[model samples]
Target: MIVRRCVGLLALPLLLGCCVVHAAPPRGFDVLHYSVALVPDIAAKRVQGQQTVRFKAEQALSTLTLDAGTLEVTSVTQHGRALAFAQAGQQLHITLATPLQRGASAELQIRYHGAPAFGLTFAPEREEVYTLFSTSQWMPSVDAPDERATLDLAVTLPPALLAAGTGRALPTRTLADGRIEHRWRLDTPMPGYVYGFAAGRYQQATQQHGPVQLRYLSVERSPAQLRTVFARTGDMLDFFAERAGLPYRGDYQQALVASTIGQEMAGLSLMSEAYGQDVLDDADQIALMAHEAAHHWWGNRVTCAGWEHFWLNEGMANFMTAAYLQQAQGEAAYQAQVDGWRTRLDALRAKGADHALVYADWDAPTADDRAVVYRKGAYVLHLLRGELGDAVFWRGLRAYTVANDGRSVVTADFQRAMETAAGHSLQPFFDEWVYTAGTAAQ
Candidate 1:
C-alpha cells in the first residue's frame, strides 16, 4: 500500500500492538481457503454476510480463534451443527465440536452483519471501496500478513451496480429479488489484507497483454483518462517480469476509486479517482502506478513476515519503480526519483525523526516512522544495488523472488539471497542501512 499523505496514526485497540508481530495467527492451523457471501445495502451502509473457512490443523486444538472486528456474529456452526462461540473485542473464539487432532482438516461457517467502521466505505454517491486491513471489518479471518489463503467471494447488490474483486470474475446471476450476484475466484493464496471488493455504477475496459488480461474499472462513463494513465501497463509487466525472472502470476485488475491512497492486492490495484483527473500531470502518480504493479512480485507473491521488515515489501517496490524509470525514461529520470526520496529522508533527519529500517518500536509508529520506512528503505536498496553492481544485484533479486514465491519472508531472507548471488557477505551493508538508525553513509 502507498499513500500520498500521512493520515492520522493507526490505533487498533483490540490488538496488543499496531504491528504485525503482535497480530499473527496462532500456529495450530493453516488456512486453506475462504468462501465469503456478502449482501451489501448501499443505502443502509451495512453488510450482511456468511463465511466458511477450510483449514488443516497443524497441532491438536479444541478451540479456534480468528480476527473479526466489531461485526455482529449471529451464529457459528460446524458440519450443520451449532457450535459454542465467544466474541471479545476483535477476536472470535469458537470451541470445536470435537477437538481437531493434529494433521486433521476441518471447516467452520460463521454468519455476521454490521456497518463496518473501517476497511470498507459505503458511498451511495460514488463507489464503495475497501481499503487494506479492512477485510476483517467485513469478513472473519486470520488477519495477518504471514497467513495466506485462497478465496471465493460472492457479492449481492443492486442490479445497477457492478462488483470488482480479487481474481477472475465468474458469470453473474440475477436473484429473484432483482439483485445481481457476482462471484470471483482467487485460486492463488494471498494475505488477508489483499482480499477486497468495490461495488458501484462502473464502466469497464479490457486490454490483453500476452497471457495476462488487464481490466480497468472507473466510475466515469468514458474511461479514456484511466486508459491513458495505465497506457504503459503492458510494458511494465514485461519489464518487471524480465527483471525479476518471474512471469505475471494472475490476471490484473485496476480500479480508480474515491480515495487518494493506492493499494496493491492479490491481482488487483486501486488508485484514487484524482489520479485520472487533477493528479494526471503528477509524475509521482506514474511512479505510484509502477510501484503498485511491482508489488505483484514483491508484496503480493512473496510477503513480508511481519511489519518489522516492511521494507522487504515497500522498499523493493520503490526501488523497482526507479529501475523501471531508468529503463523506460532515462537515467536522469531515475536519479531524480532517487533524489526525491533522499530529500524526504533529509527533511525527516532535520527534525531528528530518523529511525532504523527494521523499526524496533513496532507498536506505534509516528509519521516519521512511515517516512523512514518508505523513503529510507528505498535508499538502502539503492545503496545495496550500487555495492553489488547491476549484474549481480538484479540476479540476486530474481533469485529472491523465485525462491520465496508464495511464501512469507524477512529481511534476513533477502540478505541471504543477495549474498549468495554476489558471492560475498552483505553483513556490513545490512548493519549500517537496515539495523542502524539515521541516514545512509555518504
Candidate 2:
C-alpha cells in the first residue's frame, strides 16, 4: 500500500476502476514462470526488454496471446528458432511453429521496445524510478491478480543506484555495455500484479526480525528518519503473525520514493516521501502503514478469488489496522478508528451512494463505491465482531487465514469459516449486510 492502492479511482476516470487491467490470459496453458530483463531509458521514458515466458499446455495449442499493452514486438523465439508473432491492439499474438500437445511445455522469448503508457515512472530530475500498478504497462505479460507464477527480473541501471524488488536479490553484475544489472528471483508463485521493482540512489538500512529481513530505504529523508518512521515495522509484523498464527518468513522492505504510492509487491513496498514526512510530524501516524502491512496477510497472501471479492483483501486489511490500534494504541483509539469508518459509511448512505461490499461488477465505480469497500467493509467486520463474541470472531479469522494461506478465496469462504467458529449459520447476517448495500445507519 503506501497510499493504499485505491488508485485515483475518485479523481481519475478509469474504465476498469481499480479492477483487472489485464485481459483474460489465453485459454490453453498456465504460466509457470517469467524471466524479464529490462533496460529503462530514464531520460527518454522508453524501455526495452526481453521477456521469457514458460508455460505448460493443458490442451493441444498452436497459438497463444498475452496482454502486451502497446509494446512493439521485435522478435519471438523458442530456444534459437523464430516464431511468428503480431501485435494487435493491446495483445501480442504468438503463433508457435511447433504446436504444443496436451500436457506439453514450451518457452517463448519475446523482445519488445516501447515507452510505458502507465504504472511506471522515470523522474530524471530526482533520479528516482518506481512502478505503481498495471504490471502489463511496464512488462508485456498477464496482469490478472489470480494468475500466479514465479518471476525473475534483471533491471539494468547505473552502477551507483540501488534496486529493490519482489524477490530475493541475487548478485549484481556489470553488463558489457557498462550498466549494472540487478537480478532478483521469486521461487514461489504469486500473481503478476504483485510483480514490480523500484530503483534509485537510496540510502538503505537493514535489520533482522526473527527469520525475516526488514529493510528500509529513502532518497530524500535522512537514514535516521527512515529508521524513525518505520520503527514499528517489526511490531506490525509481530502483531499480524501473532493474530493470524502464521509467521511471515520472507524478507520485507519499504522504500520511500516521490509519488504517494503505497502499493505492495510480493516482498517490497514502495511508500511515498509525503507519508514519511507525515510520520515525522506524528509518530502515531502509523495506521496507514499498518493497513499496508496488514495486506501482507490479507491482500498478498490470501488473495481474493477475483476482484469482485476484493473487499476480502482491502476491508480485512483496513479492519486489521483498527485491530492493531486496539492492541497498541488502547481501546479508545480503536473505537475512534471504528467511529471514523462509521462517519464515512453514514456519509455514503446519506448520498444513496452505498454499494455492496461484495460487488458484482467492477465496470465503473464512483469514489463512494471505493469508500464502501474500505469503510463500510471494515464497519461490517466491526458489526460481525459484535455479533460473534471476541473469542469466536478471532478464532474464525485464524481459521479462514490459516486454511487459505497462499490461496484464492471468495466471500463465501470467509462466511463458512465464521459459521464454523460460531457453530451456527451467519448466512442471515451476510445476506443483510455484506450481500446488499451495507446497513450503515442501522
Candidate 3:
C-alpha cells in the first residue's frame, strides 16, 4: 500500500507506534495455513464466505484469537463440531471444546457473510480488487505482517469474469449455476497484507523468464500495451536476483488491475490504470516497476517485523530501485533520483513535518511521514552505501537479504548484518539518520 500523508490533520504521537509491539500471532499458537472460499455478489456489493484456518498450538490453550475484522459470524466449528465464538472489534475469539496442548495442531472453520469493512472491492462498472491490509475484511485469519501462512483461495464469481490472486492458479472449475471457481495456492508462507484477489473481465498475457513466470492482468489495456508498460519486468527480476544473490522465491509472479496504488505482494504487484494513459513518462513507469519488483526480495522475502520497521521493506526497495537506475540508466539518473528524494524530504521538514525514521508513528502514518519512510529511508541507505563504499555496500546488502530470507526483521537486524559485512559499527549512522528526525548531511 502507498503511504500518503493525511494533510490538514495533526499527526498522532510517536508513542502510539509502541502500543502495537506485540501485534502479531498470540504466543500460544502459530498459524499454518488458510483456506478461504468467497463468493462475491457484485450487484449487492457484498460477499458470502467460509474460511478454515489450520494452526499449531505453541502452548496449551482453551481459546484462540484471529483477526476477522467486522464480518458477521454465523457459526464456527472445530473438527466438524460447533464451537462458540465472539466477534469483538476486529478480532474473533473462538473457544475450543478441549484444551489444546502445546505442539498440537487443530483447525477452525468459520462461516460468515457481509460486505467487507475494507479491502475487497466490487466495481462491476470497473473491476473488483483487494488492496493491502484488507485481507481480513473478507476472510478470517491471522492478519499481521510478522505472522506468515500458506494460503489456498477459491473465489467463485460470474463465469465471464477472470480472477487473479497470490501464488499459482490451479485448474478453474465451472459450477452448474454459470459461476466459475478460481483456485490458487501459495506454498510459501507470506504475510497477510499481501494476500489478495482481483476478479473482473480481464485479459491476461504471460511471459517466461527462466523459472519465473510473469503474468499481466488488465481489463482496460490491450496485451501489447501491457507488454510495453511492463517490458522490463524480466530484466528487473534478473537484475535484483544477481545483485541480491538470491533467486526469485515463487514459481510465478503477476501484476493485476490498474490503479494509482502500486503495492507489492509475495509474487504479485498491482499497477494503476493511469499506466495506460500518457500521463506517466517512461522513466517514471520504469522506476515504479523497478521499485515494486525489488520488493520481491526486500519486502516479500524479508518482511519488516511490524509497521514500526516498515522502512526495512519500503526503504530497502526504494534504495534497490535507485541502484537499478544507477546501473540501467546511468549515474546521472541515479543521482537525480536521490536528489529528488532529498528535495521532497527537505520540503516536508520545512513544513514542520519532522519525524524520526525508526520511530515514526505507524499507527496513522501521514503522507508527510511517508516521505520520510520511503524517500528519507532510501537516503539513509544511500548514505550508508557511501560510507561503506561500493564493494562492502553490495556485499552487505546481499548478506542482509540472504540472512533474513523468509523472516521478518527490524532495523537493528539489518544494521547487524551490514555491520558484520563491513566489519565496523554503524550505530552512529543509524542514530543520525534513522533514530533522529531531520535530514542527513549531504
Indicate which candidate wins on lDDT: 2
User: Candidate 1, clashing residue pairs?
Assistant: 119-134
Q: Count of backbone clashes for each model?
A: 1, 4, 7
Q: Cα lDDT for residue 268, model 2?
A: 80
In the range 68-161, model 2's lDDT, one tens digit per residue, is: 7767889999988998998777778899988899899889999988887567878787677788767877777765566688999999998878
Estimate TM-scores for all models.
0.92, 0.92, 0.91
Worst 10 residues of 2 by lDDT: 6-15
Q: Return the TM-score for candidate 3, rounded to 2 decimals.
A: 0.91
Better of 1 and 2 by lDDT: 2
Residues 1-442, candidate 1, lDDT per residue (tens digit)?
A: 7422211123322222122232343568988999999988777888899999999998998888887888889999998999999999777888999998899999999999988877777777874645454588889887667889999999987787766888788999999999889999998889888888877788887898999998887886366766776888888989999988899976888888777468888788887777766446754347777888999999888998776677888888989999999998899989997898888888877778876677545445567877777778888899888998999999999999999999999777888899999999877777767776634434
Q: Supply candidate 1's per-residue lDDT for 1.
A: 74
lDDT of each: 0.80, 0.81, 0.77
lDDT of 3 by residue, 1-442 (tens): 5743211121333432222232433458989999989888887888889988898999998998877766888999987899998888677889999999999999889999888745666665764645454577788776557889999999998887877788888999989998899999989898887787777788778888788777777787777767767777888888999988999866545455645467777677776667544422453447777888898888888998766678888888888899898888889879998898888877877888866776635656778878788988898888888999999988988998898899988777888888898998876777667777745347
Compared to the true structure, candidate 1 yields what TM-score? Answer: 0.92
